[model samples]
Target: MDESWASTIAQVVSQEYPAAMHHVQHGPGHADPRELHPAFWGSYDWHSCVHMLCSAVKLHGRDSDLGLSALLDQRLTPYNIAAEADYLREHPLYERPYGWAWAMQLVKVCRDTRWEDALAPLEAQLEHNIAAWLRTQQWPVRHGVHSNSALALLLIFDASPRMRPLVERTALDWFGAERAYPHEWEVSGHDFVSNGLAEAALMRRVLPESEFDAWLQDFFAPEAYTFYTAPIQVNDPEDGQQAHLIGLMLTRAWLLREIGKPDGTQQLIDAAAAHLTGTNFMATHWLITYALLAEDALGN
Candidate 1:
């Protein structure tokens, strides 16, 4: 793996985040995760953009640079400042006192910088979010991916000492449950890639690595992809349209890479890049992640 690949993507993702946030302003001064540039609107849609930005910045190695630290400071504050006053009291439908992006950005930033000072307030919000998650018995929480993904981060965060056990228990419960709400829509009878990746990462963090390894094989089985509905053929020449396919393919590809299967990983990356290139949905976050992964595959 090219170590610099992570940094390159980090820079590209960082460059776009501020502009993407600018387009989605929701409240008096808040940005909506929905509205992006016209052409890139479908390409880098709101949720995808936010997810990609969070994921890319979370890439582990690049967080220590003073330059990157300053960039994060620029985007993190005012990006969230607009909602500070009303965050808990009168936030939007999906907006929360502790949003998935907010938590993700904070935790990831904390991974490298003593920016521990910057994250002090965010730690309180994460604590609140944990309580909010535990208090509910609802299968799929109010927000779409936000709740599950945010919960996953509670454990992923290196700083959350108290949260480790709770996240472990919650993840095990989700995995052991007889039925799930299905995060994957393309698959008629399956969950989405976003959900798969979230749960997979959670399992890896909470369980023994060997057990996690077994689960990865079962989830990425070829038969499972065939049964999947929407993203069955991500790069089907017939329709030649469908950006969401990248999410499913890349998730599986990344899973392979995690286990050190470079061959399988590169195949999926190639397929996803073919679909994304020159597509209108270029602005989506999945594409960004895909691009970074592809760059890595190319030894960039």
Candidate 2:
């Protein structure tokens, strides 16, 4: 990997923070900064802006942008958490499956920043929303694109001993039905379904070993790889962090390493790293994090 990868990420993040914040302060909710030209609504939101900033921290291992960091740190308070919960409580897309995922992400960010009290209402809201989804009269569970993503994070990151059973049960319930394969192919014009499945593999890695291992094998088998749709080119304009296809691939690669399958793991990582580099997608911060983790995992 080129040494400049980390710096590239930092530069993009450094540019994005101010731009995102400016839009958040002035633009409508759900607006994304990338869509600012035609005044497209819902391009980004506070949640997305915050997620990007958090991604920066994850990449750089430092909160170098104190102003942006301070803004997010303060915004994730109990009051703000309650407000977000209440807002999501009323909106289905924002409420159940979707809300659960973003809430989990937010919780992780808060935890990273030591915002302990913020988790209380956030957890309550997540449980309430998830329970409501469970009780919905629908026969076969139909999780929306965004909601499943959120719920998957909960499965991956739920660290509470008391919550393990609940988490597993939820996972089983969500994945219970034989998925006919995800149908949504484009989000921002990137291959959304396969990317989601890839992320699911990582999420399950921390689940019950037997179950997770089985699912991982199914997702990573040669048949699946050959049959799977490749994401649109990195610069396809519609593609954003879908470029972090590397994150998904690396996450899967690490799972393989955990299972003593290092050969294919290296191959996947190299492929992902190359894709990210050719398209200028993976940033420096992420490359560094990925490299360090991969090296540490293999003890190389």
RMSD per model, one decimal: 7.2, 7.4
Reference-based lDDT, each prediction: 0.44, 0.44
TM-scores vs. true structure, each candidate? 0.58, 0.55
Q: Report the lDDT tens digits of candidate 2 across residue range 115-186.
A: 657666766666666556655534332232333442343433443334445555655565533343442432
Candidate 1 lDDT, 1-300, residue by residue in tens: 224434443444434433433233445765443222211122123344334434445554444442344544554453343333234323233333224334544455455554445545545555665557555744533232334453344334434666667656766775643233333443322222455544554566666778766766665554433333222454433231344455456655654344444454555666555543333333233455545543443441
Deviation of model 1 at 293, angstroms: 7.2
**How well does candidate 2 match the true structure in TM-score terms?**
0.55
TM-score, cand. 1 vs. native: 0.58
Off by over 4 Å in 1: 1-71, 78-102, 114-116, 140-161, 177-201, 209-241, 256-263, 274-286, 290-300
